[model samples]
Target: MISILFLIAVAASIITAIMGLSFLISCIWEKETRAALYAGLQFLLMLGLVFLLFYLEATAFFETATGRAGLILGLVLTGGTFALLTLRIGSNPQALQGTRGLMVGNVKRYDERDIVFARNRTLSPGLEQYQAYYELHPEHEQYDAARRKRGGPLGKPGSIDKPQDRPNVAATLASLSIPLHLSTPEKFNPSQHPEFSQQRVELSPASASARIKGYTLSIGAKLVGITEINPLWIYANRGEIFNENWDDWGREIELTHKYAVVFATEMGFELVGTAPHSSTTIASMANYASGAFIATQLAAFIANLGYSATANHLRHYDAALVPLAVDAGLGETGRLGYLMTKDFGPRVRLGAVTTDLALIPDNPVDIGVEDFCKICKKCAHCCPSNSIPLDDQEAVNGTRRWKLNAETCFDYWGKVGTDCNICMRVCPWSHANTSPHKLIRTLITRNRYSRYLFNSMDDIFYGRKPKPKPAPEWARFDE
Candidate 1:
């Protein structure tokens, strides 16, 4: 029986080492090579301890009365410690009611232009809005004129305009300008089509929502939720589509849809670490493609079942996705001013499909992430353009949240020829979803004390501002 017990312990230890080796490989593949090395070292250390155990049991070195008792006690203590650590797995972020009262009255209404700073000269030199903004903000006059004369980021005198760079610019422009086919509501009147079901076949709203979320996730979504249509989330008019003469609050932007199904598709970490490069853009487009696939498929499924649904994908957005995602319980807004889902943090792209279907509504979750963001400004510190806020949350658009300077952010992206994602790369919440990290996340979400420890530990484990790693071999070479 004693020999059998020893054999069992040896078997278990070997199994653990194997598991650790597999996890280490995954970490290395993710470019977390240091973490992988640490895991491997820990496994070797544990294996050495296991060898010591076998020598003690076999050689009778620990079989004397005192030695045997000491051996038994040590074994018990080790088992208890292992059990404690093992128990710290599979944590779920708590679901709490988010800010509920009416939006603050003192909040300032920001012009859509404030979110983005553009060289006024890039606009038609004599355009009324361009002339007025330049006159108002005179300090930008020289810089704006310089950039305008050079022709905006995409125009002549830019890097892309250089003769040798033409081929690259043309290729990129072709990809970026690919048309997203979007149909206006007026284009498809419901009365003209065959009668669609006014009600769902599912008996309960909860059941229908669960089925929809499951189906969406299985298709490609990393996270999914449904929320009631909030007027605040809908822009008065689509900004990119109607840049000039944007009608703000004058035109009614009502949706025939009553509910929105918000979902996110994760952009793998290794791909995002190479931001401001083609690899990063590929990762971004991959997420967008995945999101579009799932959203459109789900919408088609709903339509086939007789309910009217429309997929909001990529540049064809009718309503803002991030705010809708936050309100839908898919995630909380992070310091970078993007929705950070529990699993993927800010390292994912979002899509939404709004419909009139009677689906269960998800409450916006307040998982202490706001409090966590207060102490953790890793993203702010790493932001290339200093666009992310380092200060406390302030009232913006009637809601209390951190608002990033979009103009500076976009300008940085244009300069790099890629969307710089240093903020997402350095975020403490963007760590790999391992058992140890999940336990820390659970404690931090529930107790305020753990949040401080985690913030400090994260900065220590993964430097305060980690360096941008080189892209993978696969990314560097054009096949």
Candidate 2:
């Protein structure tokens, strides 16, 4: 019995030491010096514990029943505590009651005209739409005008920061030009064929779903999901930018699609690491471009199959991407107002293709995003503009959720000459998908206690305000 307890103690210490060592190595490879230092100390402590246990077992202490009993009790207590943190025990993470566990209210369909991006575009005094909109929403006129004056219209030449303006403009134009240069001769005419592309192509929902998902991945989409179109996810009007699509701005957007194929493309980890910098903008645009390609190609493919499909990308959006992503089972909405995907978190750009094609729809997923975000407010702490809310989610748009201060966030973007991704960069879920971090994600996704455990671990290893890394060589213009 004494030998058995000694073996257990030594084995547990060894296992812990191995885990610590793995984390230490992972942090070092990821260039997280603070995390690596913490991991190294943990490894040494476990190693010391192993040696102490072995020494005690070999000494006169093992001969005493009281000493043996005390050691056994300590091991049991410690092991049990860790087990609770690491294992589900009796918890079901998917049985999530999404908001503080008592979820409430139906989300109403949002008006595209009301979004900050639309408001910013309409702020020009020369635009007739600007005068008409401000007349109705006079309360927002002061702040919106201030945002334009203070921040100077979000990025590059107009902002307070200007050194990287050339590189930022270069990166942005590369993405903006995709739609103009990368299209086929064929196009959708909303006034003409509003439903089926030409003729209906009958296909079973399951097989169509499988084929579509496979093709989306093949076309560079990192994540793809299908959901029956939810009216609430669709926009009420055309308000993204001044374009010829509508007779005038804010025209009612009438999308008659029954299903939406939502997809996301991953942003480069190293590039995103340089948040609030030109590099992150480069990363953001790169993925947005990729998403545009994926969405357009999927739309074309479906159209070829004799189904009506309208691609929604950054340049031509007609819906709320995050909610559509959520309904598609891709992820849940986090407090930072981004879709928290299971594998990639919010470190992705979204695109969608709404169509009349029959496909199996994915049920919404609950990967403990709400539960975890409740504990890990790292994004809120790291946000330069204080845009993300640190408190519990409140009712917004008729649903209980966190609403980011769009005005302040966009204004900060103009100040920095980039859309600051400090929130996404510092999130624990934003860690590289390496073995140790993957394991951590799985553990947290399993239960609430595990979420709390990993959340603290993230803060301890990676500090509350994690430092940003420098951009990759290719993205650096100064050099």
Candidate 3:
């Protein structure tokens, strides 16, 4: 009996050690030095405990029934330790409750051209849009004037030392050469088609819709969810849509589509590490293209199934995306006010397809992210333009949340010629998912105590404000 028990104990210890070692190796593969160290320490600790048990046995500490009972107690405790560690590694609370919607009110309808207008205004000797904008917000003129003098990302004396603009512009132009207007149903004039008035499409049942979404998302998209229509997610119209006196413009523009599908394409992290560079621009445009393709294809597929659907992609949009994404169970909004999904943080580009199809609505997930972001202002601290807010989430219009300075943020992007993702690059949530990070995410979700620990540790491991890395070779055209 003693021999058999000893053999079992040894086997269990060996298996535990192997798992720990495997996790350590996996961490190294992800370039996570801290995770590897943590994993190695866990393995060593287990080994020491097992060896100590063996020493006690040999020294006659468990020769009697009482000693044997004590031996059993130690083994059970050791097994519990392993279970606890396993739980920490496997459970991600953020993934638990699915999607949620943010019902924002009182916010003014920002023009689609607002960002472009803001950027242009910040440039030296600004354009007509700049003067018009300043007439509304006169206090911003001084700051705008100062920022405009800095050369843009693609401008002369920009971030790139050589200052080369229009990388593969020929290729980009060729791609855009294909008539994009024809892609829009409204532009194509659906009324012109004889069958358009005669044919009607039916929505699939909720169960079938779920299956379809699951199957289609598995095709390539990173994450997918279905959400009910929310009025706040739509924009009160602006720009040409507003100027044309369209009834839907500048109103709560909720669609008849009962189901909204939100999915994300992973941003190549290695490429994003090189912010304010040509490579970063390339990656951003590439993701936009990829998202557009995915959304277009999905919309077409839904239409073929006899249901009306529309794909909202890059460049053109009629509704707000982040709230829709959150409602669809994608992720919660983080400190940077970007949708921070469970798997990718802000390292994703989003696309959506709305349809009349029936589907299950995901529950709102609370992984303590709001609380964490409240305390962790790493992004705000590192923001070069100081556009991100450092204070608590406040009521903007009516809904309570952090409202980013759109003008300042857009101004920075315009000057850089690239969407400055300095905040995304430095976000603690953007860290590569490794065992230690997984453990920390789990603990923080469960106990407030762990939140404090992780907030500090994250800064120590990766600096409170990390510097941007060099652009990747594959993305660099002017090497």
Top candidate when judged by lDDT against the true structure? 2
- Residue 86 in candidate 1, Cα distance off native in Å: 8.7
Against the reference, the lDDT scores of all candidates come to 0.65, 0.78, 0.64
Clashing pairs in 1: 117-407
Candidate 2 residue-wise lDDT at 233? 71
Where does candidate 3 have its weakest 10-residue lDDT segment? 239-248
lDDT of 1 by residue, 1-479 (tens): 45555665667677767766665665676676565667678678767867877887778766577765665666577587555534423232332443333246553322333223323322346666557656766776676565444443432343322443344445445444432322233212122123544544443677779888999989988889899977666655333332233342123445689999999988877767765555565567667666666777777666655677877876445677887887788878888988887776788899888887789998887655777888899899988799999999788767777889876776666665555677887887776676655656666656565667779867755678777666666555233
**Considering lDDT, where higher is better, how would the candidates rank from best to worst?**
2, 1, 3
Question: lDDT tens digits, residues 1-479, model 3?
Answer: 76566666777877778767776776566555665677678789878867976887788767778877876776788677655533433233543433222334564544443454423422234445446656765776676566556643433344442444455333333333332432455421123234455465554476656666775576678888777867556655432231223342234444678777778888777666666555665556666676777777777666655566777766346566777787777778887888887667788888787877667776655566677787789989988788999999777655567878867777677666666788887777665566655655666655555666678867765567766666555456465
lDDT of 2 by residue, 1-479 (tens): 77787788888889989988998888888888889899999999999999988787778587798877878898899888787877654343442432223246766677888888778764576677788788988998888887766654335455333565576658766886775443322432121244553665667898889999999999999899888887777888767663433344778878899999999988777878888776788788778778778888888788777777888887677788887887788888898999998787889899998988888988777678888998888999889889999999898866778989987888888777787888989988988887888888887877678898789988888888988887767776454
Lowest lDDT 10-residue stretch of candidate 2: 183-192
Pitting candidate 2 against candidate 3, the one with the higher TM-score is: 2
Error of 1 at 188 (Å): 10
TM-score of 2: 0.89
